[model samples]
Target: MIYLDYVSTTPLNQEVNHMYQSLLNDYFANADSLYSLGLKTSALMEKSRELTAQLLHVLPEEIIFTSGASESNSAAIKGCAFQYQNRGKHIITTAVEHSSVYQSCIQLRDVFGFEVDFISVDASGNLDLKQLEEAIRPDTILITMMYVNNEVGMVFPIEKVYQMIQKINPKIKLHVDMVQALGKMPIDLTHVDLASFSAHKIYGLKGSGVLYKKTSTSLVPLINGGQQEHQLRGGTSNTATHTMFAKTLRLALENLEQKYQYVTSLNHYIREQLTQIPDIVINTPSEHVSPYILNFSCVGYKPEVILHALEMYECYVSTKSTCSSHKSDISRTLQAMGIREDIAKSAIRISFSHHTTQDELDEFLFYLKKTLKTIKKQR
Candidate 1:
């Protein structure tokens, strides 16, 4: 099948796979053990952490390893909210964030009586800075938003937003869910205080993730056990997974420019092809969106209809975030962008990777055109 869902997860790269296997064989000892083998494993884990921090342009102590983006996000959001509950009970975020974030705010409100203000978005899924500024108040203690939206591929103006929030309330901690943007965009944590990223999104093993907390900010640990990860997260370190995460991140950074160009070419080609059809509406903006993901509505067609049609053509895609793929609710991102409900229901995401070839795009365009035609006929 043609895999067009890199936004969900990417396959492990050969180099990362080799590192994972090698580390599993040689560094199986617990990183916290006092034995010689354990000490060696601990050293390797620390080295990986240091390498990851260097890539993120932060100190090694700032990187906290977790199971995945979900865990890191949970730790960052809940950890900060709970830790600073006495200081404030209000938070700010966008309406188009992933379920891990949106749902965390919901739970925080219900469980802790914390108030959450959701900033609105425009038609291209861009958050309004004015709305965000108005949403902040003296009680607001945290502002968390995703760097790149998972489903719609819109890149938030994170640096500008961070600066704005810092100007208003320098003590208000800023957290970023950088899961989708880790490999696709540049991430320098010098400005962002708390950022979460996962390895599987960049062709590494699953269950390996990082949460960067700037030295100035402090958070309560969500997990209580061993002192691993600076006592922020518990459990013995998964040495192999950590090594593989570092390997994949290093490779992605080395090929960043090349991959960006490749994905941009693919997105442009697909946009060119879709424009000829005249029946589809590109939900994502051509100029401001990420090159790796494309979201659009198949006019006169529901997403389920087009999805079924594409499956017959052996082309795989998705309708929304993988975390909420099973839910039939209208995409919160599209809705927040002021898109009509009918168009939102018809919206689908076609995400690609640097490995995707031009020929693959040609074939996909052909099948997609055919599917659209079939969908039109049935309607």
Candidate 2:
């Protein structure tokens, strides 16, 4: 199948798979154990942590490993809110944040007695820095926003937001969910206080991610057990996954410059072709989007219907967040971006990876055009 759903999860590369296999065979002991085998596993885990820290431009002590973005987000939001509640019971975030970030704050509000103020987004899905600044009260301790929106591929102005926050409240913690932006963009962690990352999104193994916190920042532990992952996340580490994650990150970075240009060209070609067709509108902004993902709406067709039609031609696409695929609700992202409900319902997301080829995109175009024609005829 032609997988156009790379944003959800990418298949593991051969090199990553080999690393997984090697770790599984040679280092199977739990890192928490005190034995020699455990020491070997612990050393491997530390090495992986160092590599991840290097990638994110943070100190190794600041990196906390977790299951994925969801857990990392939870740990970042809840951990910070709970720990710093006395400083402020208020938090700031955007209306278009991922459910992981949104739901985590909702839980904090509902269960922990914290107040969350949501900033609005512009039509292009960029957060309103002025509105965000206005939302920050004396009690406001954190600002969480996604670097790259999952559904629309909009690249939020992270540096601008950070600068705005710095001007108003230098003590306010900055948290970014960089799940979709990790390898696609160069993240210099010099400015960002805490950021969430997932290995699976970058063609690495699943169940491996990092939560990077600045040296002065403190976060409570999510999982309670042994003193691992700087004592912020506790459990026996996933040695194999960690090893593959580090190795895969290195592999992903090797061709990142080339991949960026390639994906931009591909997105431009697809956007041009699709825009030429009747009743189609590109949802993502041309200037401020990562080329890896393209979101659009077709006026005459529903997303689910077109998704199924594309599947028949062995072309895979997604309608909404894969995490909440079973929900069957309208996208919170599109809604926050002020898209009409009808248009949002008709939106479909097509994401690509380094493995995707131009020939595959051409084939997808052929099937997509045929499907659109069929849809229009029915209308």
Candidate 3:
């Protein structure tokens, strides 16, 4: 299939797959065992952690391996809320966050009795920093938002937000969900207290991801088991997959500028063609959006109709964040941006990768046009 859903997840990198197989075979011993083989395996995992930290410009001790961003987001939000509730029971987040961050914030407010402020975004999918600043109060303990929005690809002004929050309440922890921004955008977690990422989003195997927690930040454990993940998260990890993730992250960051430029050309091509279509309404902002992801509405047409139509031609795409796409038909992100309900209901996302070829995109556009025309005829 001609896949266009890189933001949801990517096929494993062939090189990373090879590394995983090699590590799996060589490091079969339990990392916690006292035996020599176990010690060797544990040491290798530590090296993997160091390499991953070095690539991300953070300390190895700050990185905690998790199942994926979902777990990381939940752990970061709930842990911070639980740890600092005595100091304050208030938190801040945006309306356009990924499901993991959004739901985690909701759970904090509903079940944990912590007050939450859902910061609003403009019609262009940009957050109002001034409003966000006003929402911060003495009781606010954390501010969690996405580095890049998953559905519309709107990049948040994270550094500015962090600086603002620091000035207001230096103790307020800043947690950023960086899942979609991993390989698609520049990253600097120097001032961020916590950040979350998923391996599957970056051509790495699933069931492995990273949660960077600053050394100074205090967070309660989300799980209690074999004392893994620095006691933040417990249970045995997929040591083989986690160990090979360093190489996977390295490969994703390599030649990022070249990859970005190439993908920008693809996005430009798709955007140009998509705008020419009669009933299309681009939901992704024209400016300040990542080229790796694009969003729009197939006006008056159910997104699934067009999606299935393209699928018949062996083209794959997504209607929204795959994790919660089945949970809701309408795009909550679009609606939060002030889009009309009908338009929001018909919204779909087309995500790209550096490996997506111009020829492949041309074929994709052909199939899209054909699908649209066929639907028009049926109507």
Which structure among the candidates has the greatest lDDT? 3
Q: Provide the TM-score for each candidate, comma-separated.
A: 0.96, 0.97, 0.97
Clashes of each: 0, 0, 0
Cα deviation of 152 in candidate 1 (Å)?
1.1
Point out where model 1 deviates above 4 Å: 375-379
Model 3: number of backbone collisions: 0
Candidate 3 segments exceeding 4 Å error: 376-379
List per-prediction Cα lDDT, in the order shown: 0.87, 0.86, 0.89
Residue 210 of model 3 has an lDDT of 89
Which digits, one per residue and each the tens of the lDDT, describe model 3 over residues 1-379? 7999999889999998987888899999888889999888888889989999999999999999888899899999999999999999999998888888889989988898989999999999889898999999999999999988989999999889988977888999999999988987788999799999899999998988889999999899989887787888777767897797788899999998899999999999999888998888889998888999999888888888899999998999899989887776676788789999888888889999998988888898899888887885323
RMSD of each: 1.4, 1.5, 1.3
The digit string of per-residue lDDT tens for model 1 on 318-353 reads: 888878988899999998988987778888899999
Relative to the true structure, candidate 3 has a C-alpha RMSD (angstroms) of 1.3
RMSD of 1: 1.4
| Candidate 2 global Cα RMSD | 1.5
Model 2 TM-score (2 dp): 0.97
What would the per-residue lDDT of candidate 2 be over residues 312-357, giving only the tens digit for each residue?
Answer: 9999999888887778788888888899877787888999987889
Report the error of model 2 at residue 161, Å: 1.6
